[model samples]
Target chain A: MRDRVELLRDMVLVRQFEERCARLYQEAKIRGFVHLYVGEEAVAAAVMGVLQPRDRAVATYRDHGHALLKGVSPEAVMAEMYGRVDGCSGGRGGSMHLFDVAHGLYGGHGIVGGGLPIAVGLALADKLQARDRVTVCFFGEGAVAEGEFHECLNLAALWSLPVVFCCENNLYAMGTALERSEADTDLSVRAATYGLAAWSVDGMDVDAVTHTAQRAVEMARGGAPCFVECRTYRFRAHSMYDPELYRDRAEVERWRERDPIDLHRTRLEASGDLEPGAFDAMRAGVDAAIDRAVAFAESSGLEPLDQLTRHVYAAGPEAGR
Target chain B: MSRVTCRDAMGRAIRRALLEDDRVFLMGEDVGRYGGCFGVSKGLYDEFGPERIRDTPLSESAFVGAGIGAAIAGMRPIVEIMTCNFSLLALDQILNNAATLRHMSGGQIGVPLVIRMTTGGGRQLAAQHSHSLEGWYAHIPGLTVLTPATVEDFAGMLGPALADPDPVLIFEHGGLYNVDAELPDEDPAVDINKAAVRRAGQDISLLTYGGSLPKCMAAADELAASGIEAEVIDLRVLRPLDDEAIVTTVSRTHRAVVVDEGWRSGGIGAEISARIMEQAFWELDAPVARVATAEVPLPYPKHLEDAALPSVPAIVGAAKELLGRG
Candidate 1:
């Protein structure tokens, strides 16, 4: 069995990080759109846990969780949120576009369904180069409405690209309910039409997500695309600016009762996987990391004004020749 | 030197790219078995096989985006959008992903992708297939737009475009595909950074690019017969415009006429005119003149379509009018 404490630690870290980010935003520290991954931590923790270092990942705008799970240092990501030069994207990309190319994190694409075709291309390169690597692309249920979703799915299946499309179905596209936006709310069923091996899992359960993600990655490694629909929920507003007029407060409380962190902790306690005071110790450690990250971001310098347009293109042979 | 059509020259260039780099591949609809919509990749499929020469479905967004991703993942992909008209369907991927990825990622990624599409009109293909919209693409910042007018450029431009560390769009004029000219045995090393002066003169400068280049050249010949020596400068690179070449020609000639296949209002010719006004206004003997297509969708009938696009005689008339000799 996987380490339940470690999994819980990861989920708690994401929870604490996002909570701290919200406080920072209120304190006039972090700017730009901050789409917190509050209730959907299990999806990233489990899915990213299965990915090897050589494997690549493409995430959506709500990507702080994915970036952390993919091994992007909390300090770098927090610095990025603060728009500091020490940020993962060199303070160029704000909250939505967290990119760590060295770790094979392709991007935190802001556009819905934009990262799918890119994941297919990354898989295409790996396939052509005879590399045994998988590219995991994460998108939300809302992306199903985009034309690129259909197009990318068809191409991945037609070309047999090695990609694991993880659709985190958080039940709402901003405020529109899944049933209202989609004709049929079954995302995995639609993906199956493209000849991909598709399924749905309980995203609230980390064990279920881990098991399904492992199988999906294995299938993708064998030269076939797979889709996983993680039926999850987002407890917070879509972004900090959202007033959340669409959903009722009663429904939020209902889903919050099934919080993935509390559920995972309860399961771990019943299974004797957690020692007494372990959860508190884990929280303390995570809080310490978040404190260090905030300090780093606070002390970090802003990028110089003169270098505003430096990274538009890489410095290549065409420069200063 | 050997005489060849622009079609053959481009085909040969693609063949050379495939032979030179194992990472270079061609992907588009009808690029393989159908030999491309304009036969620009006629023999590449048979020669390079299905792996390198991939024939994609009509999903422009998917394939183009895939090409961008492939470029990021260490492959040099030349994506063909059958015509500039159809590229609208793939604009999101082109403008948002391909163009912005490098800056978005803080230089962690560079899309070394080459997108080739046929631009301009002369064969009465109607509104959709006939408009020259390379100017629309030139409006974007992150792209390098190349319009190759000569057979030499057709044979030479792809190498440099592929070698560049950014996204490049090559707009090949549909009218010039069948036009034949002598090309060097070895591919000429042409730079995509500077404009080339087609003809030298001391009178009015006739500046143009793509399908309009030949018309301007013919217009220069017509002007020469009437004792008006007109200079011609082909703007090979449209995005990072060769302002130096434009200024040099206008400074010498003391007058300019920008000939473009697109409409006059806010077209590339307008940008060129504005540039001249900013840099070479003092050198002008008269206000700069522009010869552009009428502001209308290209018509289906040959006569109407011909009237809608910039013609050689129209260019000549504009030059004569600018020189006060019309």
Candidate 2:
């Protein structure tokens, strides 16, 4: 019970930080396509509950929340979003690519469905090297239809690689809804056909997601792969460019009424687990962290223009020959 | 040392790579149980098992990306795209992820991977399977493209390519796979970084690579008979071109002809000509000439395909024009 409240505080911090990012994106402080995991906060918060620091986690472009929940500093992520050299990937990755090798956050890939196979290979290496570490890969329901998604799941199952394939079903891929896009709306069933044990959890409930992910991770570490489909919603547009022409206003309002952060906070307050003072402190902490991150990013130097062509090839001095 | 064919040389290279390093493995459609579509990986499946000599589904993009991921994670992966033409399916992986990972990661990761694809025409495999796309990849900045045209290169270049930390594309000629020649008693391993002069002359220079090398050499032979001494330069490494050798040869010969199996406009031949002009424009006695494939899909019929691609006669004709013989 105590652990749940602590994790709830972490989730609150991530949610508050992302809400600030949305404001920043609108204010023109952050550029490029910004995809915030606002309604999907519980997905990261829950997954992080089961993931150890030694285990790996790779997510998609909507990954700021995941980075924070996975133990990466909100400041580093926000700094990366600001494109500063002091950030996690030296600001080269920007918002779409948030990689923290120190925290086992392999990357925040920009390409759609690009990180699934990479996560499979990471698990293969860990298993081959005889490590007990498991790699948890997070992608949206849109990725489930990709050929790479199928191939990666098949390989993971066949090799019995230690990997947990987490699908955050946000109901829409950019503008296309799950009903309009996937032939099989039941993503977990689709994953089950690949010989993997699949689970579908209510992504709005952080406890449900946390419990489901814990089992999946345990199963992966037990010499097999597992899949978890977290049924969630994106409260905002897919990116800044999206005009939100797909869904009805009523649908948005309905999902917004069940916002994951508010739901968790309500549950905590009703159960007498969290006080108003604690919530105020958590909000202040998140605000201060975002402020510091923005300052750090502004202070960090930009990479020199002359070094743009550097790291194109791994060959150092001899490669020039 | 045991005598080996080009096919066996590639096999031996893969074998040596696998045995020497636990990280090395082979992956491609039909590369495992079917023995590589061209028998290049025969007997490897039984020896290395399904784990190493992996037979992948027809999903080129996924497997190729997986190969990149594996390489990034410290494994030396050799991804075999049955033909360079099929590499188009995996273009996103090759061009987007594999090529840009090093720069995008801010030098944190390097793709220590090799993508070996058979290239060039002459097998009557039609348009979809018969084209050479090495020139397309060469235009990219990060990758090192190698065209090993001889039995020696087929036997030798793999070690150095695998030893290098960066990505290397080995374009094995589709025709040269069977063209056997007497190899040296010792491993006459050559440098994969420069152009090798196959024949020396003082009149004109013929620059070519891959399947076009034999035709250029034949043109050089024919030119010799016609009292036109033509130096033949085989460009083994295409991307990081041997500009020094090319400039010196063009300066001395005062004439040059580039023979490529690809199309003429915006082809590797054009790039080479542009580079020559950039470096040694004044030294040339005449403008550089080029013999390339006719702009059309390569047909399956023997004669039409032969007529479409650059031939020995075309090479000779271009060489003669450069030498003011035409």
Candidate 3:
């Protein structure tokens, strides 16, 4: 068992990274659509704890937390968000399309529900190759309605693929609430309909998300893919540009009171696993990391127009062959 | 020596592919115990078992994406859609994901997946089931399209397709499932990226593939009787189209006729004709002619269905027009 100090540090790091991204978005340093993974740090930090290095993960637009926790360099991810050649996707994909193949991070897909099948495919590959790797796919409540989601679940259940479908029920698919969108609000029950085991975990509690995801990931690696619905809420607006007119401010404030980062801090203090001085030190370290990532992104160069069509076709001098 | 149909040749090719690589597997509706909708995958389930000859739910997009994923993971996956028409439902996975993954990943990943599907109309399967969209797919850069018209093409293309580094889409004509011919025991291995001259001649070049190849061959025979001596070229590979072969043949013949069962406008025939005009314009003695299916949803009536698609008479008529014999 990891000391509460390390778990608290992980949560703090993810929270700081997301807070920095929100600042960058406001400052206009990172262009294109930016969806910050704030208020949902527990989902990534906790789930990533038990993910083996060989395992793969796919996330949606709200994916910075997932990427950072997956061990992709903060500098590389921020550089990608800034559209620099040194970025993971080489600036081809902006904030919403960050890809780090080296870390087995498939991407931060822009399209809702599009990444579900892709995650299943990755898991299917692991099963076919007889590899002991499991793939964890993360999506939002908004994705439950898409045909791609249901279709992939059917195949995954039918073949018993090694995948853990983690639905971060942030309660909104853009501006629409889960109740307004899905006929069945309980997303876990839908997975059960497909013949796979399903469960719901408190997304705001890091330990809860971690423990539940560990069991699901184990089942997936053991030969049957599993589905986990993390009943969480996003305190921030859907995107940097969203006016957030769909939901009430009181609701956001209520969820914010149960913020996962603050909850972890309190738990650490109560358990005598962390002193106030140590917590302050961890925040300072996180702040320094964020500063360095911002500097790296600022110094990184932009791709030239001559290479606009470079990766569009898989052949020639520009194909990065 | 053994006699086999195009469908039988495809089955043998699949069996050989399965034997050659344990990674090679078939997955689709009725491809296993049902022996495929057209029986093209007949007897595969019994030999390879359900593991290799797996049957999938009616989720074209998901399964096709899975095939792409499997291909990238170092396995050879052959996904079959019931027909070319239904592939539209899987277009997101096929075009956006499978076709673009190689380029989008900047060549870090290449999908060696093969998607086989039925195409063309003659069975009166109605509007929804019968149509050819190979021409639209040929326009894409990353994918290679093939239409195996001859039994040799059916048998020869699979091995090479399985070896190619990129994705390959093979359109097996539903109308030609029962086509039978004497296939030589000695395998005449061929490339999947080149066109083949089915018959050699000098007066005119008749270009076609899939269901229209036999019609072009019949037209060639009739034109030969009339002393036109038409050369027929079967385009086994659709995309990265064998421009050299078509240009060289048209340059020799100096006149050309294209036969396609797709619609006339913006069809594969239209693209072929445009290419001939651009590359071999000076070699041509007259304007190129074409025989394409009529522009309409294929109706259920026998005569309406027959009238909606290209036939032997249509190809013969187009050839005569190009020869100024009409």
Candidate 4:
């Protein structure tokens, strides 16, 4: 059995880190579309728990939680939010484009549905090179409407590529609800139409997400692409700029009642997985980590303007000549 | 040396690349079983098998983006779009991902992908299938745009483009696919960076590329008959244009006429004209002139299509006008 306490700890860490980010945004410390994963922590924590170090991942813009869970340092992620040189993307890509190639996190793609084809190609490379690795591409419900979604799914299934398409259906694609965008609201069914094994899981429950993702990862490792729709909800507005005009206050309140962290903590406590003061100690540790991240972000230096165009092309024999 | 068509030369290039590198593969619509829409990959499928000579569905965005992904993941994938007209479907992947990935990822990844597409118009394919759009791709900063106008270039450009660290787009003129040219036994190593001086003259410079090169060469012969020596420069590389070559030729001749198959306004000819004005203003004996396609959708009729495209007469007229000898 997997450690329920560790899962709970990760979710709590994400929650605390995002809450701190919200306060920082309010103070004008972090700029440019800061998308918080306040309530969608369980999906990232659980899904990432099943991925090995060798496996690759491609995440969307609201990727702080995914990056952190995938082994990108909290300090680097926050520094990226601060647009500091020490950030994972060296301050070139801000919050919406966190990238850590060393950790196998491909990128935080800004465009919707942009990562799907890249994921397929990555899987194709592994299959061609005879490497036993899986590439997990995480996109939102909004990405399903893109032509690339259908095209990539067909290609992946046709090639039997080692790819696990993780759709974190947090209901909103920017302010538009999934039901409003998609005529057929069932995402897993749409993925199944591509002829790959597809299913959905309870995104709020860590155990459910982990169990479902583990099976999908196994299927991908066996050279069959699989799709999983994580039915989750984002508690906060889509971004710092969103006034949330599309969502109702009552709906947000109702979804908050199923807050992933609270449910996981309650489950752990009921199963005797937590000691009397364990939750408090874990919270304290998470708070300290967030504080350290904030300090690192604040103290980090900005990138020099002269080096602005350094990475436009890789350093090569004829590059920049 | 042996004579070969541009089609056979390109097929030879793909075969050579596949044989030389275990990581290289070809993927595109109708590239495998159907032998490519233009028959550029006629026997590659049978030779390399389905895994390497992959025939993809008509999903340009996915396959092109997949090529970029495979390139980043340590595989050299040469993706072909049937024609430049259909390449608009995958422009998002080419512009947003392949061109931006290395810089956006803080240089952690490089897309060593090569995309080849048939461009220009000569067949009665009409508007949708006929139009030169290489100038559009040339506008993007991170992309390397190449227009191979010779048989050696058509056969040799692919190797260096695949070896490059960034994305390279090769635009093969549709009309030149069947043109015959002699290839040396040991094909001279072609550089995608330099513009080739196809013919040398001293009276005026005729600058052109791709489908316009032959017309410009013919115009030079006609000009020579009129005692006007026209220097012919084939602009093999479009992006990071050989500005030095352009300026040097114009400096010697002191006059220039740019010929392009694309529309005059905002076309590559316009860019070359502006570069001449910027860098060779003092060297020019007369104003730089341009011969380009008439700004209309290419027609289906042969006579009207020929009239609309940049012709030898148009290049000769433009050169005479630039030299004030009309």
lDDT of 4 at A301: 99
lDDT of 1 by residue, B179-254 (tens): 9998888989999889999999999999999999998888899999999999999999997899999999999999
| Tens digit per residue, CA lDDT, model 1, A96-172 | 99999988898899999999989989999999889999999999999999998999989999999999999999998
The prediction achieving the highest DockQ against the true structure is: 4
What does chain B score (TM) in every candidate? 0.99, 0.97, 0.97, 0.98
Residues B1-326, candidate 4: write the lDDT tens digits.
89999998888999999999999999999999999999999999999999999999999999999999999899999999999999999999999999898888778889999999999987889999999999999888678899999899998999889888899999999989999899976545888889999999999999999988988889999999999998999999988799999999999999999888989999989999999999999998898898989999999999999999999988888888887778
Of 2 and 4, the candidate ahead on TM-score is 4
Q: Report lDDT (CA) for all predictions.
A: 0.92, 0.85, 0.84, 0.91
TM-score of every candidate = 0.98, 0.96, 0.94, 0.98
Candidate by candidate, in order, the iRMS in Å equals 2.6, 2.1, 3.5, 1.4
- Chain A TM-score of each model, in the order shown? 0.97, 0.96, 0.96, 0.97
Model 2 TM-score (2 dp): 0.96
Candidate 3 per-residue C-alpha lDDT over B202-227 given as tens digits, one digit per residue, 9 for 90 to 100: 99899988888888888889888888
Q: By the lDDT metric, which is better: model 1 or model 3?
A: 1
Question: lDDT of model 4 at residue A10?
Answer: 89
Model 4, which residues run further than 4 Å from truth? A316-321
Per-residue lDDT of B141 in model 4: 69
The docking category that best describes candidate 4 is medium
* Residue pairs with backbone overlap in model 4: none
Query: Which ten residues in a row are the worst by lDDT in model 3 chain B?
Result: B100-109
**Preferred candidate (DockQ higher): 1 or 2:** 1
Rank candidates, lDDT, best first: 1, 4, 2, 3
After superposition, candidate 1 runs with Cα above 4 Å error: A315-321
